[model samples]
Target: MSHLPAVTLNNGVAIPQVGFGVFQIPDAETQATVSTALEIGYRSIDTAAVYGNETGVGRAVAASGLLRDELFVTTKLWITDLGRTSARDALHASLDRLALDRVDLYLIHWPAPATDAYLEAWQGLEELYAEGLTRAIGVSNFLPEHLDRVVALGGTVPAVNQIELHPALRNRETAAAGAAHGVATEAWSPLAQGGALLAEAPVVAAARAHGVTPAQVVLRWHLQQGHIVIPKSATPSRIAANLDVFGFELTAAESAAIDALDRDGRIGPHPATFHG
Candidate 1:
């Protein structure tokens, strides 16, 4: 029973069980934070063009002296760059900023339902993927309708869907849909950005039983549910703690107990009406 198993992608690529997220790390601090993560056995690092820290992330990787193939790097094409030409250019720019020859994964940041350009944007991703510039491509914050259209129209079925999720907001439909379509479930904001749930009775009880922090309990739940989680923390201790979840395993009763915590509690914006 391996705790950290490799999740095979639709294209047969293997991603680590957990990765570090760089959602809000300031540009200047991104390097130090990512360097700390890498040094702590984090082989995968997730970034996006909107994050404004590709340069710092790239610098951290360069300084780490790790082989390029040993790392799993992901970056997204911003919503503003959804068109064909602009999206292609954005990929190149991200590669330049990260100083990587190619990204392991790329995603369309959002469907941007108002414009309905995700189809074309996804086409751009397919072109990039076929050219070997991107190992796999997917979407983030996409609804079922968006996924249906993308898959029906010859677009890639998305290797992963990084959505706003945590114990309090599980997005069951999306997860089920992902499984139905051979897409992996990826939970972003695994901590709900540090929500009150961490102190709630159920999580606290489970944490006390396991002798781990509530945050660790919640992250462990995500892993047990077969999700690829990217938990972010600016502090090195928190970052390290988020990764120290492998030693404990949650039982069926505990898993259901935490699943009961879901009360439609979504920390991020609703994807249905989100503008970007």
Candidate 2:
């Protein structure tokens, strides 16, 4: 059995706190990579239609021999596929690619304020949730204002707000907003792609002190802070090590040092302006 702790969503669907992400991995390689993650005890898989790898993810899931109930799969609706009817059709296409009848969680990939269609897309998600097409629905890369607007619509509150959160970019405001509305905060690039952030003094010191890698230290910090993290890696060792963070705990001082590293370092597009 997977030992990773579960984070209950606002709708009470349980998601693994440390899930596997298939962001940049090519479609041709996703099946083997995701299969490795599954073999390593990762029960959660995060994918997107734009990733162009849902078919590979589906292949891996089919070959794993693990029961469907043993896995938690998540996918997103691309900006171009916004709107009530289109969103439903988009999810249908995604389900066809994933070879599943329904996804565990479906998210609006971006606010795309330029299109102003996220609200309508959210309406579609509500319909999907009601129809059992997805167990839960949420958004990604949403700012505080966008989240507020979604909540104001008086539909189902988002179950999660997946964002680019790392030691360099805490995204405290958005996270706090989600918390106030009972939406769970999920960190996408939790390690900041592992360059300077991993080499920083605090991260290195914590790693040395705990006999873990800097990546593990950072993942542990995120877990202790109660943020669900989906860290992606193609290397077998790193993929396995990423999920091996539960064995150690970081001291308050260590966590605080990482917290102080936040410098508004956003690595992705601002949700306010991004159209796609």
Top-scoring candidate (TM-score): 2
- Candidate 2 lDDT, 42-103, residue by residue in tens: 99999999999999999999999999989999999999999999999999999999999999
* Candidate-wise lDDT, in order: 0.89, 0.95
Candidates' TM-scores?
0.97, 0.99
- In candidate 2, position 62 carries an lDDT of 95
Q: Name every residue pair that clashes in candidate 2.
A: none
lDDT of 1 by residue, 1-276 (tens): 123466889999888879999998998999999999999888889999999999999999999998988899999988889987788999999999999989999998888888778788888888999999999999999888888888898656899988888888889998888888898888888988546889888899999999999999999999988999999998889889999998989989999999998988997888778776
Off by over 4 Å in 2: none
TM-score of candidate 2 on Cα atoms, chains taken together: 0.99
RMSD (CA, Å), each prediction: 1.6, 0.8
Query: Model 1 residue 62 lDDT?
Result: 98
Error of 2 at 10 (Å): 0.7
- Candidate 2: residue 253 Cα off by (Å): 0.5
